[model samples]
Target: MDFRGQISAEFLLIVSFIVVIVLVFSSIAGPQSQENSIATAAREGATGAISEMSYTNVSMKPMRVTGIKITGGSNRVISISFERPVPPEYRALVINRTVESLLTVSGVKPVNSTTVRLGDRTYTVQI
Candidate 1:
């Protein structure tokens, strides 16, 4: 047996092992990072909605609010809801995971019952 060849093989094994470990950890962290990002988006959207709602009050005149859908107005208050479709594999990780947040002129608040399913495995936000 050549000592030089054995040393090279051992080094390669160590490097491969490290790479495998890194890949596994990264895969686990990747989904967590994505979840955090989605949560942030939901919060921001809600705040924007509430801001628009507030403007309806400050306009001094009675603005005919026609539709239930909130529209951007002069007011900074807004309520926003967001939904993300989970992948088959991710569904197992987080079955029907939902997040809801409210934004008011005063501040932001997280409210219960923000996410709902319109159809099978499909989710939406209603504020």
Candidate 2:
């Protein structure tokens, strides 16, 4: 009886199955984990920016954030836009301290120019 050969073949088959399963699981989990990380970063950044801009300048009445948008694909650029426009002086504070810093900590590179529109005062930052 050649039971030794049969046992070896069964062991090899089980090991290969486990390897395939691990590869499949890794492929499924990789992008999902990245997406979750980006979402967390975006949410935190937006929240911090809103809080900072809320009472940034005591001279003017506290500003209200109308809305926030975070958009991007995995392993690509991420953009965070705040609905309310901030004062010129506070733009640097929001972008540099709140948004950029948070995104950088999450390993995202923010674009150089952060645009503040005229009417809505919307602030957009690309990472």
Candidate 3:
């Protein structure tokens, strides 16, 4: 083969290879970015629930949290229900709902009583 023709073929092959790599990487990255967004939103929602100091704030439009429900209620016992949707990238996305309150009024210390239900799986955390 002529040297010039060989060089042209090599250049084209390299360019095509680069394009394929970019497309593959971009496709993988797209889903990961979505997952991060959902996770961040969920974390923000949890923080809002704690900082606002009320389940009502979590439901408010200002907070951007959705589906806040009081599944059970009592003076000392309260069951707040909220679901955080998992990112689309996740095949089995988990929805977590937590119920927490101030365990001590004097110190304003939150006694974390959280119940997480992720894709029908239930877990509890106490702090």
Candidate 4:
């Protein structure tokens, strides 16, 4: 009996099953990986901003931070909420630098300083 066609059918079935399994796993993991990258970038940016503050201002910033990604609006922006609000020395500059660094690490090319609107209020940020 010739079995070539039967074997080819079985092989294709197995391959299709494997591809579907891989796709399902990747879909589950993709968003999680992006979130991790965002968190790392936020930490690095905040740390770099704080380090530079050392030269010009002698104050401390909160070590614990919660960075939330904000989307689904007319504009997309990142929301960085510290355990406490930012300290009051050259505050805007620090924020701008942190924003810039955050975008840079997350695979975005350098962007010029621009204004970001959160609700009715708009603030300048450097990306």
List per-prediction Cα lDDT, in the order shown. 0.39, 0.54, 0.39, 0.58
The candidate 2 region of ten consecutive residues with least summed lDDT is 115-124
Best by TM-score: 4
Please report the TM-score between candidate 1 and the true structure: 0.47
lDDT of predicted model 3 = 0.39
Model 3, 77-113: lDDT tens digits are: 2222234432233211222222222211122233233
Distance from true location, Cα of 39 in model 3, Å: 0.4
- What is the Cα root-mean-square deviation between model 3 and the actual structure? 16.3
Q: What order do candidates take by lDDT, descending?
A: 4, 2, 1, 3
TM-score of each: 0.47, 0.58, 0.42, 0.62
For model 1, the superposed segments whose C-alpha errors exceed 4 Å read: 59-123
Q: Write the per-residue lDDT of candidate 2 for residues 12-121, one digit (tens) a residue.
A: 99999999999999999975675565445555765666576665545654544444344432223345455555667666665555445445543444444453221222
Q: Which ten residues in a row have the lowest lDDT in candidate 1?
A: 90-99
Q: Write the per-residue lDDT of candidate 4 for residues 15-120, one digit (tens) a residue.
A: 9999999999999997557556545665676666666766556565434455545443444455666556666754576567666655654344444454433233
- lDDT: which candidate is best? 4
The collision pairs in model 2 are 85-121
Assess candidate 2 and give its TM-score to the true structure: 0.58
CA RMSD for every model? 16.0, 7.7, 16.3, 5.8
For lDDT, candidate 3 versus 4, the one ahead is 4
